[model samples]
Target chain A: MSSAARLSPSAPGLSGTGGHDDRKVPPVADMARIIGLSIPVACMPDVVANTALLHGYADLVGSFVLPDDCEPAYEYVP
Target chain B: MTMQGHKAGAALAIAADVRAGHRSAVSVVTDVIADIEARDTRFNSVTRILGPAAVAQAEEVDKAIAAGRDPGPLAGVPFGVKDLFDVRGEVTTAGSIVLRDNLPATRDAVVVERLRAAGAVPVATLNMDEFAYGFSTENAHTGTTRNPHDTARLAGGSSGGSAASVAAGLLPFTLGSDTNGSIRIPSSLCGVWGLKPTYGQMPLGGVYPFVASLDVVGPMADTVEDLRAVYAIMAGGAPVGEPDMGDVRVARLGGWFADNISTELRAGIDAVMAHLGQDRVIELPEVARARASAFLISAAEGGNLHLPRLRRRSMQYDPATRGRLMAGAMLPAATFVQAQRFRRWFRDHVHAALAQADVLVAPTTVGVAPRIDQPSIVVDGKTVSARANLGIFTQPVSLAGLPVLAAPLAVDGLPLGIQLIGAPGGEAKLFAVAAELQRAGLAACRPLEAGYARKDS
Candidate 1:
């Protein structure tokens, strides 16, 4: 891939206009509710902003195609 | 007793002086404590001084030497720990007010125990980002740690205090945990030597957990030699053998690693490549995705670790940390799982890169330390938060679980650094390259002048 293409913003979640499936991922506030977190009213804006940022990153990671045989990197010995 | 001109081997020299009765450990510890008390006001690097306990430990070392017994290799050298490490009889705050009321630790952290056993004394607890979450050490509970070279700029963190203390010559060495660029970021910005050892290499017992899958405790120091010596003690005292410089293969990481760097930093890397007589540049695939995976995993793990406490005392946590943790806790499980699976793929590719070269070179941060008032860096023509974006280079490397030695570049202005990356358990190779750079005058920690202190406040 060209450097310009690589540097271009690729996360649809950040733009909220294309390629994001809203039906699959709930809104930030709704997700918080489902997870049983009581985000404070004053803190909600920052929480939403950070969550939105993570959503973009999550979209980027989730879009990558992985082989079925791939396993999580969780094992650590000594 | 001053460490002005003794950056290269301060720890070893201090140990030799103590063991040979040239200086008493008690006196050394006392002088360090006094220096910290007198000099740390401008930097805000040291949060607590382990005065009485450190002095008592030094007395024991003195008695051991008097009885014709070995006091250990790092005898009487004073060091500090990032506030997350548990020290017996002290609260491990992890740099937040939320844990201020917690009970005192019953024992030292495993790495701290190792250092203490080796005759090194922990003289102070240094400042850090709350829960080791941020890159810039602008702690909400403790004030920000200022860069020693120029107090107006930030001392990159979550190991900001650890790096600053060493850079300022307050201590010969310090211990810090690196999950994602914590040690490397601070070390680079403060112009010190730091090692982010391979994952799972250092025992984490009694150390405050950050990201379970990623956390690795290591040492920061004023010189490559001191860093190696401290790392040996932390890694169970087996001395790391030096690799032949002639046989060590070097490559510069291009692709994502080559972007957003300053002219000075670019020149620095060019000089290093020239010195090694190689211009081979290796580009790793999917580096953007690798960095993203690390970010996701860290957030998810760190959020889960603090969920119980955050649930009870949400308001007590740092506002910046609390918001991010809550967001991480709410992440879809599928996203977290995908990140983990992608990590395996990324690690495989990184290993393949290592097969071609023994060591890979990259910049630790894009530029020098950001200004304190404006805590941000320009990336791809956009100004972003330094706290979140400074780790763009280091995070991807952290995902591969490689050992990276952050080496300070010898420059004329504010300090810059480069990462010498090696395969897992390839720290000896990293150390060899760092020593070569230091010897060739291509890399060395810039010493802060004695009169350099914050004048604004």
Candidate 2:
């Protein structure tokens, strides 16, 4: 799932202490290692799951490109 | 009197009794600690009872009153703090074993100190989602907090224990932080009153951070009056009555907020609208996108916060939370930047919509707490994990950083809640609306009673 139409129809998962599946859904484990994350092979399924979810969120925001004048919402300065 | 046996079971009631010599502060705190020990086994809302320290603080309140001095507005009231807030002399775990070895806090959180000054005793540290990350308080390290209304159900999370404790009548009120619906989700699930005040309106000094840009600490209680009183103290104001509701323009939210709701929730909103004579509805543009933006921002910010720790003890982290954080840390820089920019645009439109109404009414969650065994909620006709989808209605509003008060619908079935949203710095307006609902019996928390359960039993 990467965007609205591309969004994956969902289901509940990882029923408490999820089982280990070494299969990588999208090479997210390798990406984790690239970013200096020492993720275990057993965590491959979870890392993959997270990758898809984050990417879906990214795709949603990717549509509305920031205009030049839009202010960055950083720390809310009171 | 036992806290649960009190007529209102609110902070102000207990405080007035203690100050007027009707009850002793020592006895009140002691009775509450004992009651929690005996009863909280079903709810699992409390992590550590302050024990001797709590009684000691209560004793000071008794001393102040005995010496002919005012012991403060919240005199002798016992309240709990979510474990993320530093309690002096206690190692603030933020509900994780990883922080078990950290040094104890040297002093109390600013809010804790302020409450103590007003004679509120910090009786215990309530449980939370580790690092305040998840909506389901199913912490891998700490045991899950069960909803008091039905021990078989899940307590909405990150701030689950705080809301559950208040719902269980174990405390008058409890403080919880809302990054994105932590306070509201659990409050609604547990059928308690909760306030996620305008972002950055209150101090977050000693509270643990989840998404810094969106995090704000607030209070949950069994009554709106209690929430209003506690919020004032937390914001460094004095105890006050409900604000004027005159000339307040109320409207229901339509479009995305109007769809995908359970029948009971929809009926609850209709009942409220009918009571208030508000037929007008306001719609915000691209709300699904707004919700997605909040999700992305939370992941990126939370991922960055734990990146350093994940480098060393990644497996020690909760698998669910860890995976999300890892994914977020790797989120493209462009995505984070664009979300922030969208925030500016979305916030402007939300504010513009508010110019037409003083308060926006919307459902807090689709319906009641999901069963722990089956942790799923129905969203747009699909069943999704309650953990991920419980925040759908709440997250979109979080994007705008407006103030929201989660008032449990006065339904005898499973607890349902509604969001009373106000513009930024518009807490007074929200309070006024919530008070009116409470007065009219349209909104009231159904605190856990002995043998509380559905008839399906």
Candidate 3:
């Protein structure tokens, strides 16, 4: 049997090896509701990845890149 | 002692007398068992003793040794397996009353089998949080597992028994599983060494599940070498032979690792970094969110695993663990999926970042072990869950399925440790770094006060 079969309750869960399958994925909005922590702007990439395939939404074509002046730290080459 | 005996002691520094024929494994085990009997009343670390069976196993090892047979490296060594592990013919109570009348395991856990294959003998089942959920070992079912350093404080959980047993010298080393800092938290709190090897490097068969995705079995000992030895044996890998600590390149994880930790813990990390002469601190991005994501995944998966039990036997579990598991059960499946997906992204990012660094350092626990009922401590002027704070530095790494060693750092009288994390399947590298830390006076492990003396029979 495959490793997935060996695991309990074929839900899409993180494997011991740190990979994931499309089994029983936990709901994103519900999790945020439970955690109740602010979503740092630093987490945009994670948010994008987590939402890409939710409810058959395949492509997130918009660019979230900021203008060079948004943060002077990365604005220009020294 | 012969060569095999020498090999056994090499890890714990107990080999000198054994090799010199001062005492045999049988005698050592007998003395340790007696000590446990005397100390466990106060410590409550050992749930059930395998006295007769353990004695018999030790005698068998002695007989084999006398017959001039080599029993590999761990022959005759007294070891403890956490209550969550199945050890054939013993009730795997998992520190709960629900399994009080459960049948004994018909076979040993894979880790136990591997240890036995190397000639190690199982002595007792260590205490833990019921079903390995909580960080403090305040098991309402089984009495709390106390810190050996300060009985008034906790030994950190769900590997509380394993950590306490090793810290108290009841056993030289013990097996433990980490879902979220279960192994490392207690090891730090109790002033011993605990390794959470890269996930899946050690087999999980015969061990009860906590969070299937995050649970991993490793060993806790009083020394890094012992941790390495036990890891090699349990994982079915050959030892890295002799450690070459001089060549280790250390990584001091700053940013999220540095900001929230306590002054004492930060001092410990700083001391170790200075001693290693590679104090360049590197930022590990996304660690904060990663840790939060890990908590989300652990709860959702753990609840899913025990949903039936929660529905029927809710009252059986410790109230703290049961509540969390129930909440996890309520987590919409999408969030759990997002957490796992986030884990995939985080793992890849961590691997890429670690390619330039051999190991990353952080405080094993956010602060020192707290008194069992001491409530909460102020961290950065904010009040957090007393139990959750202890595992703050550890949860993120465990989520990434990376290896980590909670190696003790020097503290005045209280015990504190720094966590050394490495990429997946990097236990050998983690140990090599730990050995270097020990040499630099950043880490030390000593056997607990001699608990009992050998009785001449």
Candidate 4:
């Protein structure tokens, strides 16, 4: 398979909309659990704020158009 | 010829003196340690002084010289590394207390080993942002690194200590890692020369990773010559050939790079362009997105690197760094993938721009070092955290993986710097432009005056 094909989202709920839909996304707390991360109460406010900030950046990146041939800049070589 | 007292000479000059038997390597090492010990109290740039080992190494150089064998090109030159680079037998804290219990490195970082082979002694481990996360080197563990020019202001980081020590004349040169402007930002704010060489051009072995794709180690120094020498040694290659100034093409980066700069900085750049007699300006496309892409990528990569540790000891992390990492760790995989895809597009555009011009010049920071008391800069007419926003110009350039030479502009006030950017593996062109600027007196590292460290001064 081509690199872009491998990068395509195959999991349900992760494809098509490009993660821009707010409804499809989980809350920071829920996402933390899904990712196996435990953010403490004192750190939640900052984490939430930071996650919101990243989402803003993510929205900018996701909204851009890319050709089907546009592979990720990173490659894992072993 | 002992180099006693606080002020340090250039690395090349120190090496020459030692090689000529005018000065013993031991004296040079002892003098630098003493100067850093006596003077660093004001700036707090050094985290740990490698006194005994440095002196011992210097003695070896002197012994080699006495035996009529060449030590190396950088023989007897004393330098420091950002706390992240492993210095054999020293624990690499990476400016965090969490790693205090980690076992010492059994060997030196690859670049440090190369420098040692060239006869340079590692004198100290410098301060930095925790895990190289932030631009400001206000560490929760090691304390802040003050600018040598004005102790009241910040020395832009995560290479703050590296730049500050060089600017303060305590060390001839220092090693720093630039992921997204760690080397350039501090070098600019502190009034010194620094090079963030072509990404992946230098070895990374034993160097702590931060955003693996973006992380590159380079030197910050008192002069372009010194920066070039240290870079050549670290790269394990002969020095880059002298660039033919007549053949080098140069242009200013407009649009995104042109915005958010101070009036004096604009004038300084204008003067440089006038000196070069170049009028062309190349504006990059989608720089905001490029910077945003770098941010998202760094957050995700950095967060993932520390996820395991964050799971067990998040509380021990710098409060400022942990939250960002946790948030990054949870970023939707789609976001990270998108950023990488966009990066490919941006890199192509940058390479296309390089095809038209051999070098591109941009402001390293929007202005001089922001005062420590008011750690903020006005960007897009809004006051933003200087710690995060300082890399406005630098972060975008990093995404493309090109080499950048941060040159300090000669000004009577605090230091301002400009980035002389080049195509990948095109450091020679950047060096030529920087040398021309230096020769014209438009760019030079402003030396701190004697007794400037005193509070009353």
The better-scoring model by DockQ among 2 and 3 is: 2
Error of 2 at B385 (Å): 1.1
- lDDT string for model 1 (B1-457, tens) is 1225454478888898889998888888988888888889989999999999999999999999999999999899888999999999899999998889999999999889999999999999999999999999998889899999889999999999999998888888899989999999999999899999998888999999989988999999888888998999898868778889999999999989999999999999999999999889999999988888889899898888888877677999889899889888888899999999999998888888888999999999999999999998988887877988899999999988889999999898888999999999899999999999999889888656422111112
Candidate 1 accuracy as lDDT: 0.87
Question: What stretches of model 3 exceed 4 Å from their correct place?
Answer: A1-78, B1-22, B241-246, B452-457
What are the per-residue Cα lDDT tens digits for candidate 3 across A1-78? 231121111223233322354333434445544644223334423332333222111111011222333321111111
TM-score, predicted candidate 2 vs. hidden true structure: 0.93
Per-candidate DockQ vs. reference: 0.57, 0.45, 0.03, 0.35
- Docking band of candidate 3: incorrect
Candidate 4 yields a Cα-based lDDT of 0.87
DockQ of prediction 1: 0.57
- Candidate 1 stretches greater than 4 Å from native: A1-26, A76-78, B1-3, B449-457
DockQ value of candidate 2: 0.45
Residues forming the 10-long window of minimal summed lDDT in candidate 1 chain A: A4-13
Best candidate (score: DockQ): 1
Per residue, candidate 2 scores C-alpha lDDT tens digits across A3-73 of: 22322322123232233433213456566777787777787667767777666566667876667999778
Off by over 4 Å in 2: A1-27, B1-9, B239-243, B449-457
* Native-referenced TM-scores of chain A, all candidate models: 0.63, 0.57, 0.23, 0.62
**Share of native interface contacts recovered by each model:** 0.71, 0.67, 0.00, 0.77
